[model samples]
Target: MAGVYDFTAKSLAGEDMALKRFEGQVLLIANTASACGFTPQYRGLEALHQALGPRGFSVLGFPCNQFGGQEPGDAKQIEEFCASNYAITFPMFAKIDVNGNNAHPLFNYLTNQKYGLLGRSIKWNFTKFLVDRSGKVVARHAPTAKPEALFREIEALL
Candidate 1:
């Protein structure tokens, strides 16, 4: 029963934040990178966030550098790039691991609840976890899965 609501994580600003705050909202929690091909997915994610945020949907971005050092910039640089390019206004968290012993607790719990097509371990950057209103991990979207493909699932949960 250790779900997403049972965890806390650092924000992009480095403040501790309880995941419980997002307990009753539909969420698209993604592990992101600044220099990867899927980096452009931020636009789509922002689009989704803007379109559905008022309806209780959110896209939470977590910057990760584990895959080929794609998100190596400091938080400032990451912010500049995201804001300047995609105009993303959703929540963005500090850089963290998505797999292995040091993976972020929320992500560890998420991948445990919903494994990917290849398996449980995260394969690359931009992997997304969809969480329902009750803090349950509802689905896992791969790197190639566009943000638009997630609308139906999000709508169902909303």
Candidate 2:
């Protein structure tokens, strides 16, 4: 079976990022937006990255505009917004679709590994997928699931 490491995504800077680089690290992969109700979650996500990054844990943010066009920004805008507003230091990917036929491959794999409450399709922005050190999908968190709520699961993986 293919693992999370098998995927590669474009960074906000337009560089191809191989997920294999994060092998053996616990990951919190989240679909993010800039102008949504859950946009404030970026702060908590950054907090988690800052607090746990030294321990082989990291948060990967992927900007998605599929929901209400909340993240309707180009790479530069998204990057600047994240940096200035939330001081997001973790890696943020280029904008991409998180649902429908054009969904990114990584998200497609994620949904297949762990479906949401209603179904596999991501319900909204900020939906999170917790991946263990071995690249296994450990849990799927809803958009409303606070980043702090993931501490225990991340600690167990670490």
Candidate 3:
């Protein structure tokens, strides 16, 4: 996939959600882990989503346990954690492997479009990809990068 709209992903409900749902919008696609040091970024993400969502921008959170198995919970548990802890309102997808041969195709496409500090492979959970309204991956952010730090580019897209 060359752009966010070029892909589809399983929602927490296990239903196929087309990336086209975000057409003409800026999207922040992130691989998250409840136990990762960057887990707290969820708050910032939620803030961004709420603040910019009305302006045609969104944040999509995908849980991944591949890195050190940081996100080991099932769907329900993950949902509970995100709600109770971070009050996350953005969409969250099922657990996916973000590394190795079993990596999700969407992530594979994202990494190729925007390499991280560690190159194509994502270094850890919370790594983020910014997709412009055209669906193309525009930037790759390290796990430590704060969500608030991305507002400028996201606004530019909007």
Candidate 4:
């Protein structure tokens, strides 16, 4: 019964972060890209973080370049883009593969917990997973699913 808390990943700042630190908090875990059509969703995700963060909610963004090579920047570049463009205050992690053999362990666990419309592999960037306070994958949101659409579910978990 491995939960999300059982994982660890490197942050955009290059620090090892244990997912257990987020235990008991509702999480919106999204695989992000800087140059995609859905890149603008960062703003909405920031808004969600601002609105619900104090109520035990957090949005964790993981930059992924697997899709169209849209996120081909290094960690520093990604951090600067997110800060300058979206003023994103939420946590963003290092770039990692979201599919294929070299996928990050956290993502591997996530997809195993809940499949997307296209099946086990993530169809595109910005694919989101909503995790409850107990670290269970509660819902899987497609890349097209707007950040605002997750408010009700987040509120319920809060």
Question: CA lDDT, every prediction?
Answer: 0.90, 0.95, 0.89, 0.95
Local accuracy of candidate 4 as per-residue lDDT tens digits, 13-127 = 8999998999999999999999999999998899999999999999999999999999999999999999999999999999999899999999999999999887899999999
What's the distance in Å from true for residue 157, model 4? 0.8
- Clashing residue pairs in candidate 3 are 3-135, 4-135
Of the pair 3 and 4, which is ahead by lDDT? Answer: 4
TM-score of each: 0.96, 0.98, 0.96, 0.98
Off by over 4 Å in 2: none
Return the lDDT, model 1, position 6: 81
Q: Report the lDDT of model 1 for residue 148.
A: 88
The positional error of residue 61 in candidate 1, measured at the CA in angstroms, is 0.6
lDDT of 3 at 118: 83
lDDT of 4 at 73: 95
- lDDT per residue (tens digit) for residues 125-147 in model 2: 99999999999999999999999
